[model samples]
Target chain A: MYDLRELTEAVRTFNRDRDWEQFHDAKSLLLALVGEVGEVAELLQWQPAATVREDVKAGRLHTRLAEELADVLLYLVMLADETGVDLGPAAAVKLAATAQRYPASKFRGQAPERQ
Target chain B: MYDLRELTEAVRTFNRDRDWEQFHDAKSLLLALVGEVGEVAELLQWQPAATVREDVKAGRLHTRLAEELADVLLYLVMLADETGVDLGPAAAVKLAATAQRYPASKFRGQAPERQ
Candidate 1:
């Protein structure tokens, strides 16, 4: 179990120790996050879903996937920090709101219709 | 502070209860993550970085930004879970490796040169 706050503080300390915060404005962080996400997409692209899942399960792509996903996550956490958003609470609230919007009794086994 | 484990459990339960896991193959989840990231990029696109910082600080864009960012996060967490990557440790290791890659003694306040 990892606390998001702990990770955030680690990220904060990492930046502060290096004086790298100056380079991490919201826009740059967002772009970095997007680039990392694109890498992740590229990795999984053109592969069948089952192949991707099986490879991941077998740990064949584990290290590379872990690295790319970590980049996406760290950049995201940094961006949220720069923008003054408490990501954990925001995510919890969003999940609650989504639950309200799509009650299981009705939406079970059904994808919501495209808007 | 929020535990990534708790969030992961909540997400798993949410999908299980809805029987939505069947629809969340690795490729579909990756696409969903990409789409949410696009939404985040759209929200910040074309804004001056300083202006974005000011708007976020003043809470003018807080709700929308939070919602969009939260979506990105949830989808990401779900995808990571699907792939069996334990995100917290991966991120920690990645950050540690990055610290080694760009030692503050040499790189302080300097962005790495573009490759």
Candidate 2:
């Protein structure tokens, strides 16, 4: 039940408090988003896919992957907040397009080749 | 103004319509999220950081990166939806912990050394 609007407000407040908004334009935030994401990918690179699930169930998810995931989400939230993009709606719009492009029945369990 | 709750609802409905919910659990979504994130990272790998910003200003941001970002976010949003984690509020909570761990004045403009 958490709202992205609330989190975006929090990010705004957090940046305003530190005068860091100057450092957070759409471009910079995008770069940082990718950087955090790369960190997440790096952690998963060393673990087998099955092991990732096992680690989650074993309460060991936080050893690295979870934190990196958190970082990626944080930057993403911040970027969306800065750009005035309501991610939920933006995502909804994108999904609508995706659904049209890849009808569920056609692409079920299959990866679409990028054109 | 988009609610993560609303986006989560749409994802739930979308999957339910296609019976794709069986494919989306915490573990699988996590893997997919990282995969999308990796795709985002790959696009940025060849471009210098400055070029990324330049690309944005030139109105050419989405030849690859923006879609990849959207993909990463869609998976992330879906993962949070499945896990019952409210991303915005969850982000606020994590930022609080990060703020405590790395005070703004101490870590401003400096990446923290991973411990």
Please give the distance, in angstroms, between residue A34's alpha carbon in candidate 1 and its true position after superposition.
0.8
**Which tens-of-lDDT digit does each residue in B1-115 have in candidate 1?**
2788888899999899999999888889888888888887887887788788888777658778888888888988899999998989999999999999999899888887756
**Interface RMSD for candidates 1 onward, in order:** 1.2, 3.9
lDDT for B113 in candidate 2 is 63
lDDT of 2 by residue, A31-113 (tens): 77777766655644665654554554345444355466566777887765654445655676678888888788887766556
lDDT of 2 by residue, B13-110 (tens): 77766667767756667677767766655654665554555554345444355565566778887766654455655666678877788777776666
DockQ score of each predicted structure, in the order shown: 0.77, 0.32
DockQ of 1: 0.77
